[model samples]
Target: MKIVSEKLAQDQFTQLKLKNLKTILAESIAQADRGELHNINDVFASLTKDKHEDISNSNI
Candidate 1:
């Protein structure tokens, strides 16, 4: 039981950390957009996102 509880706790912590990271990334992008910051990594991340849409699909 102790091992299971530890695993659950670790998973929860990992989720929270990922959520925080996404929030920070969004804030960094917003700040960069406003000209309040300059970080190439953030800029690159924003630009390199997968934007491929189903534009070729006839269903649309």
Candidate 2:
């Protein structure tokens, strides 16, 4: 009984430190829709070339 309680406590602690991805993504998407997300990707894109630049030339 004591061991089970200890394991449960450990699992709860680990879970607390883990991310809730669904909640996080929902919040991020909501913020983006509301224009609250900073969305600085364009700033970084200028530093790199188009990722799909070779897509058109591919033989696939």
Candidate 3:
């Protein structure tokens, strides 16, 4: 039935997403072990600055 097929497709998609997430997590752990990291505050500050700049540019 269509419903069964749709469910199977959704399950496959979920599995794929989980696999991708696991891969990303492993890469992140490896990067951390290599001392490749950023400060959270700095990241947020950069984002905030960029957002403000975007708003100012839009007003022009």
Candidate 4:
């Protein structure tokens, strides 16, 4: 009985995650349709810069 309940809970969590992912994808599509887009390279570069800044700050 305990095992079954645990499995059910895990399934519910998985479903919730999938639903959230769908919502995010829909929002991204709408944004793209409105010409609100970003360059992938720029996003990566920004993330890398932030990570480097974090590391440098930690050293101080």
Best by lDDT: 4
Deviation of model 4 at 55, angstroms: 19
The lDDT for every candidate, in the order shown, is 0.69, 0.60, 0.70, 0.71
- Which model scores highest in TM-score? 4
**What are the per-model C-alpha RMSD values against the true structure?**
9.8, 13.3, 9.0, 8.0
Instruction: Sort the candidates on lDDT, descending order.
Output: 4, 3, 1, 2
Model 3 TM-score relative to the real fold: 0.62
TM-score of each: 0.62, 0.38, 0.62, 0.63
The alpha-carbon root-mean-square deviation between model 3 and the true structure, to one decimal in Å, is: 9.0
RMSD of 4: 8.0
Report the C-alpha lDDT of model 2 over 1-60, residue by residue, as the tens digit: 999999999998668534443455566678778887786563334223333543545746
lDDT of 2 at 3: 100
| Tens-place lDDT digits, model 4, residues 10-55 | 9998898678667666766676677775754533454467569869
Ranking by TM-score: 4, 3, 1, 2
TM-score of 2: 0.38
Q: Write candidate 1's Cα lDDT for 1-60 as tens digits.
A: 999999999999889867866877788878988997776776446434422232335346
How do the residues 1-60 of candidate 3 rate in per-residue lDDT, one tens digit apiece? 999999999999889867866765676667667777465453345446756986999999
Off by over 4 Å in 1: 40-60
Between prediction 1 and prediction 2, the one with superior TM-score is 1
RMSD of 1: 9.8
Q: lDDT of candidate 3?
A: 0.70
